[model samples]
Target: MQGGLEFKTEIELLSRVHHKNLVSLMGFCFEKGEQILVYEYVSNGSLKDSLSGKSGIRLDWMRRLRVALGAASGLAYLHEFANPPIIHRDIKSNNILLDESLNAKVSDFGLSKPIVDSEGSYVITQVKGTMGYMDPEYYMTHKLTEKSDVYSFGVLMLELLTARKPIEHGKYIVREVQETMDQTKDLYNLHEFLDPAIGLGTTLKGLQKFVDLAMWCVKESGSDRPMMVEVVKEIENIMELVGVNLDANSTSISASYEETSKGNSPYPGYPYS
Candidate 1:
């Protein structure tokens, strides 16, 4: 009965969401008590495959930045534009699909939930998410919020930058990065942690900003994390600084930054006085 409820929830939520950066559901199947979701085939496979060398294609630094931005845009759309803002309870590289052109499309809506009340900041519910990507606050309090996704996405950013799994040999990547940042505080030393495949020759300033944003996202308290709209703008700024041109689609997205910024709280329900 619980499985049926979850499947119905996914179908109901995903059927209403339409975005360039989100995977589209073409159809589904429920035969012989077996359930199957049919999503548009993403030829390039998952982001996890691309980063882990499972996929033969090597992603350059520019392409990786584009992937990060594209994924951020998709999350921003979910948190801000969806009718009843959806929360992607599970966000990880494995769930991020890549098209033939390397455009990112967030997949796997099985754990997604909708925030039915616009005024409510969060929903109290049983926790459900991957180990490394789960938000600490949500894990502890069982109060799920949009910021929970921000924390997971922060882990995703660390994965993109370091090309390391969230957990390895009993060490969490977040702790490793934090300790390194604390010890060195120097960009030169930080390079040692970066994924050598795409990190070579990348601008240090841009990398620093990216790392900073990721750190902010993973802050202990959800109140400290930037909203998804802020995240989208920050990534755009980073890309522009690194000399990447904003495409027609991204240009339109940039325009919304200001309008969305007006009176929006960094922490939901805690507007600026």
Candidate 2:
């Protein structure tokens, strides 16, 4: 009964909003003391399935960028448009859904909460979110912010570029991701750590830019990370540098002018506070 009530509440809370990247709540049902929220079942399942290498579906660089853009839009909407603002509280790959066309949708709101912008210090409370993706600061001090999700998103980007689990290899890969841009820090020797599944076919500059952004997002201090909107723009820029032509919809190296889709707006909110 309690679980049903929780689902009902989450359904009611998330149903009213409509955005390109959020999973739409179609309806809800109560039966036999169980509450169920019906949603548009995404065909590609969770991003975790792709990240874990168990889905047998290979996500190319272009598709990956789209996924990132979609997710950021979802997070931005919750933080900016929702009345009083909603903090996802738990942002991880398992909560991200991919549709039949491979579009991304952010889901899971049972732990979401609303709070007004405040001049007070960030909240320090019980840490919530997946172990590998949880912000270290939140884990230690319980202070939470939208940036907490940015930290996790950084992990997700590294997962996309390197095809490694966030917590795998006993924190070795995570360390490399955190220190990729710092010359003094050494972890896995990133050049040697690319996921074998990807076969080193990605463009060098493209891949490096992705790595740099990933490292920036996972900075030890939450204030140092950029917002998801900025992250999306960074990825688009990297895509252009790599010859992907995000606006052209072609993976070919040829410089083409055919427009694919409108590019995302640069992050408008405060990335640091």
Which structure among the candidates has the greatest lDDT? 1
Write candidate 2's Cα lDDT for 103-194 as tens digits: 88999887775554484325655666777777776676667787888888887777776777766646645565444545443323465666
> Model 2, residue 14: displacement in angstroms?
1.1
Rate residue 264 of model 2 by lDDT.
22
Q: What is the TM-score of each candidate against the true structure?
A: 0.90, 0.78
- State in Å the error of residue 114, model 2: 2.1
- Can you tell me which runs of candidate 1 are displaced by over 4 Å? 182-188, 201-205, 257-273
Model 2 TM-score, all chains together: 0.78
For candidate 1, the lDDT comes to 0.84
Q: Give Cα-based local distance difference scores for all models.
A: 0.84, 0.68
**Which residue pairs of candidate 1 clash?**
none
How does residue 58 of candidate 1 score in lDDT? 84
Q: Any idea what lDDT model 2 has?
A: 0.68
